[model samples]
Target: MGRIIAIANQKGGVGKTTTAVNLSAALAARGKKTLLVDMDPQGNTTSGLGLEKNELDKTTYEVITGEEKIQNCIVKDLFDNLSLLPANRNLAGAEIELMTVDKMQFIMKHNLEKVKKQYDFIIIDCPPALGMLTVNAMTAANTVIVPIQCEFYALDGLTQLIYTIELIQKSLNPDLTIEGVVFTMYDARTNLSLQVVENVKSYLNQNIYKTIIPRNVRLAEAPSHGLPINLYDPRSSGAESYDLLAEEVIENGGEN
Candidate 1:
């Protein structure tokens, strides 16, 4: 069985999609058969991987709605050893559609079952909300990787997220666990960033990752070019950070 890890955070602009894209690429670069699932309606992960979101005919919406099979919806060769289940604005209606369906939270998990054995890791890029879509992702995942922006408001809403996770653990996925919390957009020069890191480490302790992702122009530019940091600028600090983060993820045994 492959590890299904949801890269999730309820807040936007926390490097969630960036982590999903780059981390998947890094894992594939290491020869792992990785699948990147764009669970977000915005389709950033799809577009970030050089796919034209608007040009896609089949996407995650169809898979979640049972209109298409998981294998038929997959876009392969986006990167070597990487496959993508793309998404687009069409997914915006899925939330409403799923509300009327039975066993709604289990839809994603059930769909993933058909293709779970083909990959070493399935990295799901969840939407920035604690809604049904995120719940489905959580219900499907073995664990979750939370990316927190290094700022004063960094810890806000985390308690609620954790509470929701516990609820899901009890009711949805009994084996669910938190992979780790990674600090993103870190700036060494800013005392506030350092303070935030110390604060999170003090509070979460072992739940936080030692690798901190620095804010870099290269990282921000990669998505525009439809590339991960490693492919965009392998020598950059942004690429280096994600590479180190990937090593930590692998060392921790990938959601085990």
Candidate 2:
């Protein structure tokens, strides 16, 4: 079975979607059969991977809502070993619709079950909120990777996120575990960035990846160009950091 991992952070601008797009690309480049699921209604992950969100008729919205099968929604061979379940603004209303459905949190989990064994890793890009969509992602995922931006108030909202995870573990999925925390947007020239990293290391009781994603212009620009950093500018520091992070994820037994 694939190791379904949700790239999530309730706090916006924390590199959650960036990590989701690049990490999935890096894993695919390493020869892992990967599925990138865009659970966020913003569809940034879909576009970041070079797919036209609006043009797609079938998407994660339809899959989760039972309007389409997961297999039909999957866009295969977008990159070597990479597949995508695209999403768009149409998914924005799913939260309200799901609230009226029975076992709403388990809808995504059930849908993904039909195709989990086809890939080695399933990376879900969750929205930047603690809403029903995020709940569904958590219930579907076996693990979570949180990206924390290195800046002031870096730890803000972390406590609430942890609490939500605990709640999910207790009531929804007992197998869900935090894969690790990654630091993003690090600037070596700033004492503040270093201090934030150190503070988080000391205060947060979680596994922190050694590879810190620096604030790279290429990383920020890749999404607009509809390419991952590795495909857009492979030699850039941003690409290098994500590749290292992928190695760390595999070394940590990603297959499990």
Candidate 3:
């Protein structure tokens, strides 16, 4: 079976989607059969992978709402080993539509289960909120990778996110656990960044990946150009950092 990992952070502007896009692309470049699932209604992940969100007839919205099947919503062979289940603005209404449905939290889990064994890793890009969509992603995932921006408020709301994870583990998916935390937007020139990293290392009782994603212009530009950092500029520091993160993730294997 594939390792279902959700790239999630309730806090926005923390490189959650950036990590989702690049890490999935990196894994695919490493010859791993990877599936990138865009659960966020914003659909940045869909566009980041070069898919036109509005042009697609069916998406994660339809899949989750039972208007379509998961298999049919998947866009295969976007890259050599990468596939995508695109999302769009329509997904924003899924919570309200599923409110009356029994066991709605398990809907994503059940849908993903049907295609779990077909890939090596299934990476989900969750929205930057603790809403029903994020809850569904967590309930369906074996683990979560949180992207924390290195700044003064890096730790803010982190406790709440951890508490939510604990709640999910206890009430929803007992197998759910935190895979690790990744530090992003690091500026080596600033002591504040170093301080924040040290603080998180000392206080947060979770595995922290060694790869620190720098605030690279190329990283920021790639999304607008509809390509991953590796494909856009393989020589850039952002690409190097994400490739290292992918290696660490692969090294961790099925441990989490």
Candidate 4:
């Protein structure tokens, strides 16, 4: 069976989608057959990986809504080992509609059940809110990775996210666990960055990753070209950081 990891955070602009796209790409680069599931209605992950959202006939929304099978929905990307279950604006209405449905939280989990064993890893890019969609993702995942920007009020959201994790663990998936945190858009020279890192590490204890993603223009620009940083500029710092982060994930998974 594959290890399913959800890249999730309730806060936006924290590099959640960026981590999902790059991590899936990097893991696929390591020869793992990976699936990148774009659960966010924004479809940023879909477009960020060079996908044209209009060309997709089926999406993750279709799968979650029982309109299509995951196998039929997965579209290949530039990475040979990576496949994507794209999402678009159609997903924006799912939360409200799903709330009225029976077994609401199981929709996404059930959609992925058939295909979960097909990949070495499944990465879910969750919407930036602690809503029904994120609940479903948490229920489906074995682990959850949070990408936090080293900015003002980073720790403010941390408390709420951790509390949500606790609730999910108690009520939904008992096997679910915190997969550590990665600091994004970090400026190494800033005392503020160091202070934020210290605060997060102190709070989370060992549930924080050593890899810190620096603010790189290439990372910010890659999405515009619909490319992962690794594909856009493999020699860049952003690409190297994600590559090393993937390596650390693999090592932590004890496969290295």
Candidate 5:
């Protein structure tokens, strides 16, 4: 069975999607068969992998609603070992459509179960909100990786996110636990960034990743080019940071 890891953060601009995209790509680059699921209605993860969101017919919306099979929705050949389940603005309505359905929170988990053994890792890019979609991701995922921005008000937002995770563990998925906390958009020169890192480490205690993603122009620009940092600029610091992150994740899972 594949490990389903949801890259999530309720707070926006915290590099959630960036981590999802690059980490998935880096894992693929490391010879792991990876699947990137775009659960966020914004579809940045879809497009970030070189997909044109508007041109797609099938997406996460169809899979989540049971209108389409998971195998039929996968977009292959995005990279050597990476495949994607693209999403678009259409996904934004899934929450409302599934509102009255029975076991709505487990919809994603059930859909993914059908294709569980096909990949080594399944990375879900969740929306930056505590909505029904996020709840669905939590219920589906075995674990979650939180990307925190090294800036002001970072810890304030983390408290609520932690509370939400606890609630999900109690009621939805007892197997769900935090995978790790990754610090992103880090600026080593700034005191604020350094301070935020220290605070998050102290609070999280363990399960925090050692690799800090620097605020690089290449990282921010890769999405516009529809490529991951590894493909966009493999020699860039962004690529190096995400590559380190992938190794950390692999090691955390006790994989050789």
Candidate 6:
């Protein structure tokens, strides 16, 4: 069975989507069968993989709602090894639509169960909120990869996220583990960045990732062109940092 992972953070502008897009792309480049699910209604992950909204027949919103199977929803990305269940503005309304449903927590997990073995990793790019969608992501995921930006208030949202995770673990999925916390947009020159890093480390302890994402213009610009940094500018610093992150992620999972 494939490992289902959710790239999540309650805080926005913390490079959550950026980490999800590049990490999935880098994993595919390394010959892993990867699937990126754009659970975020913003659809940045969909477009970042060079997909057009009109090109998708169905989306992750439909899949989660049991309207379509994942096999029917997935589209090929720039890398043949990587596929996507694209999302769009319509996804934003799913939370309200699903509100009346019982067992909403397991909707995503149950939807993915049928196609669990189709890939090595299933990466869900969750919406940046603690809403029903994010709750479903937690229930469906075997683990979560949190992206924390280096800043003073970063830790504020993390406490809420952790509390939410604990509640989910106690009530829903007991096997749901914290995959790791990745620090993003790190500037080595700033004392603030270093202090924030140290603070995150002190808080999460061994759960934090050693590989940090540097603030690179190339990374920030890739999404606008609808390409991952790995494909847009493979030689750029953004690509190198994400490559290292991929290796670290795989190693953490005991995969080479």
Candidate 5 structure quality by residue, lDDT tens digits, 4-83: 99998999999999999999999999999899999999999998877899889899999988889989999986898999
Candidate 1 segments exceeding 4 Å error: none
Q: How much RMSD separates candidate 5 from the native structure? A: 1.2
Which residue runs of candidate 6 sit more than 4 Å off their true CA positions? 54-57, 254-256
What would the per-residue lDDT of candidate 6 be over residues 1-256, giving only the tens digit for each residue? 6788899998889999999999999988888888888899888899877778646659988787778887788886547688888998888889998898988888888877877787888889999999999999889998899999998887887888888999999999998889998999989889999999988888774478888899999899999898889999999989998899888888888242
What is the TM-score of each predicted model, taking all chains together? 0.98, 0.99, 0.98, 0.96, 0.97, 0.95
Give the TM-score ranking, best first.
2, 3, 1, 5, 4, 6
Tens-digit lDDT track for model 3 on 1-256?
7899999889999999999999999999998889999999999999998888999978999998899999999999898899999999999999799898899999999999999899999999999999899999999999999999999999999999999999999999999989999999999999999999999999999999989999999999999999999999999999999999999999987323
Q: Output the lDDT of residue 87, model 2.
A: 97
The residue pairs that clash in candidate 3, if any, are none
Order of candidate numbers by lDDT, starting with the best: 2, 3, 1, 5, 4, 6
TM-score of 1: 0.98
Q: Rate the local accuracy (lDDT) of all candidates.
A: 0.92, 0.94, 0.94, 0.87, 0.91, 0.86
Clashes of each: 0, 0, 0, 0, 0, 0
The TM-score of candidate 2 is: 0.99
Candidate 4 positional error at 220, Å: 0.9
Better model by TM-score: candidate 1 vs candidate 4: 1
Error of 3 at 224 (Å): 1.2
TM-score of 4: 0.96
Candidate 4 lDDT over 86-106, as tens digits, reads 999888888888978998987
Question: What lDDT, from 0 to 1, does candidate 6 have?
Answer: 0.86
How would you encode candidate 2's per-residue C-alpha lDDT over 24-62 as one tens digit per residue?
999999999999999999999999888889999999989
Which candidate number has the best TM-score?
A: 2
Model 3 C-alpha lDDT versus the unseen true structure: 0.94
Q: By the lDDT metric, which is better: model 2 or model 5?
A: 2
Q: Pick the candidate with the highest lDDT.
A: 2
